[model samples]
Target: MAEIKKIGVFTSGGDAPGMNACIRAVVRTAIYMGKEVVGIQQGYQGMIDKKFVPMDARSVRNIIQMGGTVLKTARCMDFRTPEGRAFAYKNLKEEGIDALVPIGGDGTFTGAEFLSREFDIPVVCVPGTIDNDLYGSDYTLGYDTATNTVIDAIDKIRDTAASHDRLFFVEVMGRDSGCIALHAGIAGGAEAILLPEKETAIDELIEKLEQSAEKKTSSIVIIAEGDKNGGAYNVAKRVKEKFNFYDIKVTILGHLQRGGSPSSFDRVLGGRLGYAAVKSLLAGENRKMVGLRNNKVELTDLHEAIHNHTFKLEEDLLEMANILSI
Candidate 1:
């Protein structure tokens, strides 16, 4: 077993709900295990620049309900460069960092993997993306809270749509994957869902809306931000022009989905995953991510997990959305 003395933690990529809870868990749990915790600010950039603060139990005090990470986060454009990663390695060595815990999506994990390999430091990733697209885990830490947020927005939009017999085009964030859009669309009973993996035909969506209009039913379309054919704005305009559904409106959920108190599920999962991540480091695990699989927390090699694409909507849910809307 490796001698786990000082462990470093950072939140990377986009900020998501429940990031604070995860950071709190890691700091508190690592402190409980008699290890000094270091909080790296602004993700990988902090590590490259050697910017970090000592994290204690008091540092994470009363932050479990917070929306964003107290340590903050950022996108490190230099992480891919040899100079940047080497600088990070030099800093970690100088700081005597024994292990690393990164809370982030795929891009963040990729950076962690590089650092782990370059510096011979063990990294245990805690998946913390709203996209819920990380492989080997059924759910990411911030996904449930984000989904609930999106669903809440959709519910409100539906109320206005129903009252005025209007058609609403709601946009949610999901750049490389459509998990958020797919899950929220099914849960919110959206009339249509546009994902990035598949092409959305504007004509087909408009036709469906036209049919619904004939039947005196208002429609709500959910579009992932990464939709191939522009976004909700373009789709809504086309529908209005062709079918004259002048009551169309557009609501971009934007960062709203990324902020709020994490739901109970997220809090519990974050704690469990955070604790397991520390345990992995103590157990001499390196360059791996701790994930929940088949109702058990397990570890997977970060390299394989990053390269493997694993997010997709269930066919049953898609079919149900089609049936319910039709």
Candidate 2:
């Protein structure tokens, strides 16, 4: 490996809060280390298209508090092909981007792993997804903010539900993971939470709602989008078939969970991971990811981070959520 002179940073896959904060940290950290920084707009697609922009401390100023990403992001099917990666490598060489910091989820790290191995480019990743499903990090970049957003929505929905004596099925984003649904459900005081990690039968859910109906005039059920019983609409439909007392309403948070200013926790985590990513690349580490584990910055193999998913919903929290909801 050669000394990393300039680093390129990009965000990919779905956008998340605190990405700008991560970008700021990457830019400032690299500059502080006497390495130039190039912001790759739109992620791998930008690498292929040569969408490179020079970045300095001034360029990242006033962006840490902003939500979403300043460098932009996109899903690039072209990047999945070898030819596309070759073109991206050529572009990186042309732009003198000797190392890379990619902030994104599993899909993002998978791409980085391929590019780094194929082209021998030094690359590090920062987890920047709202799902918080990644393996290494205790919390991904936007999980806190997204959960807070869901809690706010749940609070408002609870007010309405109480007034109308309604049964609200609030769906939150978490297609493959239940991190968002579990955290937000517990925080929002949902009567029942359906997660993708747990196979929740509609009949069982109805049974729980039935119990809640006996004790309360209004109820809230948090459903992850990837729940086996389907989304909030389907769950609400099935529940309405049997447990039809209060007027049932469904609210899919959708991308609402992905936007808004990041909370202090997310901002700090983003900054830490980004700073560590630059430091790792400079330290000659490649195909790695910077993550916050047990409140400390740690490094994990990118392949392990992408392939071996160690993220698990805490059983104690699940048990508590069940007990408290009752």
Candidate 3:
């Protein structure tokens, strides 16, 4: 293992709620270990473009509770190519960054792995996405905050829904993974949750809404954007054909779920993951993801973490979402 001198860290892809906390932890933890830290802005693209910022203990102060990433984040397709990656590697070498901590979703990890293997740079990925779709980690960095944001919106929607006898189709973000939708749906007490992981027939959904409508004055159906049936607007349109709602409303929620002050759970989880990532790098661990499982930090091989990973919503929770809807 090369004597680690300085580490480079960045948050890529979509910005998440607790990313600032993680960045704060990484900066402070690395500095405490007598290592220098460099913050890369806008992720891999920043590396390629040499957008590096020197960081210290004071740099991360008062940022643990902030929403979004102080480090900023951007999707970089250029980093996927050999020419672009070579440029990124050259930039890292010039900055004397021996190891790296790239925080974000699986796509972020994929880019991190490529850069590490191609240039022999040490890396540890931190799951910082709100989707909570990663395989090894029990929870991703911003999932808790995102779910809370959704539930809060739903609660507000519920007030109006109750007053007007509205049928609300609330859409939450979850591209290819319904983890956020599933959790928030259950927590928000939706009439039904349409997840990408399961097939929810329109007829079945209408039947459920009809039943709920008969008993309650209003109804809520949570839909994951990745749902096979389509998004909230389409689902609401189809449902209106069969079910007559007093007032049908659609709430996209949009990027609001991606922005918020980190919840206590997310803030703490980000700290743990960031601290573990830096510690892992110090232990000569490379090309792995630092995740909390069963409340402890564990490492998973980057290859396995990226490739052979399958995300399934908790079956019991799925069952309860229906059972409790009644």
Candidate 4:
């Protein structure tokens, strides 16, 4: 085990609400442990560009409550190439950083894995995506906040939906995963939810809406962006063609779900995951991810964390959503 004297931390992929909180945790934890911390700006691109900033407890002060990463984030096509990774590693060596704590989703972890294996660097990761689709962690950092944001929007939309007796198609994020759509749909009391995980036929959806129309003055159907019949716009178009009796409205939540003061749950979760990530690296752990599983912090092999696809939506929750809609 190499003695890790300095650690580098960065946030990548889509910016999540509690990422700043996680950044605060990483910086403070590393400082307290008598090690130096460097903030890598714009993620892997920062390494290739040599964008490094010295960080201390003061540098991360007053940022725990902030949304988005203070370190910033960007998608780096350059990081995917071997020559790009070599340049990144060279920059890391020049900066005296021997270990890393990266906070992001699978794409971020994949890059970290490549860099670590190629350069023999030590790494520990914190799951920090709003998608919450990562396998090892039960809940990713900003997922709670993102869902809360969706619910809040749903509540407001319901008001207008009821006022005009309209059928609304509200679309939320989740291209490959439906975690946000499933969770927020249930909490917001939508009439039906279309998920990427489940192929919801248009006829079946209309059947439910017809059932809803008989008893309710207003209806809200939550749709994941990756739903098989296409996004909210196409689904609404098809539904409007046949079910034209009710006035319809389509709302794409877009990136709105990605920004917010993280919920209380997320703030604490970020802190815990960040603290755990640094501790794991200090304890000579390498190429592992720190995650919260079943309310306990646990470590999973980074390869498993990146490649495994076992995360599933709760069956009971799915049933409950269906039953409660009526």
Backbone clashes in model 2, listed as residue pairs:
none
Q: What is the lDDT of residue 138 in candidate 4?
A: 94
Task: Report the C-alpha lDDT of model 1 over 196-262, residue by residue, as the tens digit.
Answer: 9878788888777777778765778999999997888987787777877648899999999989999
Alpha carbon lDDT at 148, candidate 4: 95
Best by lDDT: 4
What total of clashing residue pairs does each candidate reach?
A: 0, 0, 0, 0
Report the C-alpha lDDT of model 4 over 1-326, residue by residue, as the tens digit.
77999999999999998999999999999999999999999999999999999999999998988898999999999999999999999999999999999999999999999999998999999999899999888999999999999999999999999999999999999998999999999999999999999899999999999998999999999999999989999999999988986899999999999997988899999999999999999988999999998999999999999999888889999999999999
Q: Higher-lDDT candidate among 1 and 4?
A: 4
**Which model, 1 or 4, shows the larger TM-score?**
4
**Per-residue alpha-carbon lDDT of model 2 for 227-294, expressed as tens digits?**
99979888888888787788999998899889999999999998999999999888889999899889
**Model 2 poorest ten-residue lDDT run:** 235-244
Candidate 3 weakest ten by summed lDDT:
303-312
Residue pairs with backbone atoms closer than 3 Å in model 1 (clashes): none
lDDT of each: 0.87, 0.92, 0.91, 0.94
Scored by Cα lDDT, where does model 3 land? Answer: 0.91
lDDT of 3 by residue, 235-282 (tens): 999988887765899989999998879999999998899999999999
After the best TM-score superposition of candidate 1, give how far the Cα of residue 254 lies from its true spot, in angstroms: 0.7
Alpha-carbon runs more than 4 Å astray in model 3: none
- Which ranges in model 4 have alpha carbons more than 4 Å from their true place? none
lDDT of 1 at 314: 72
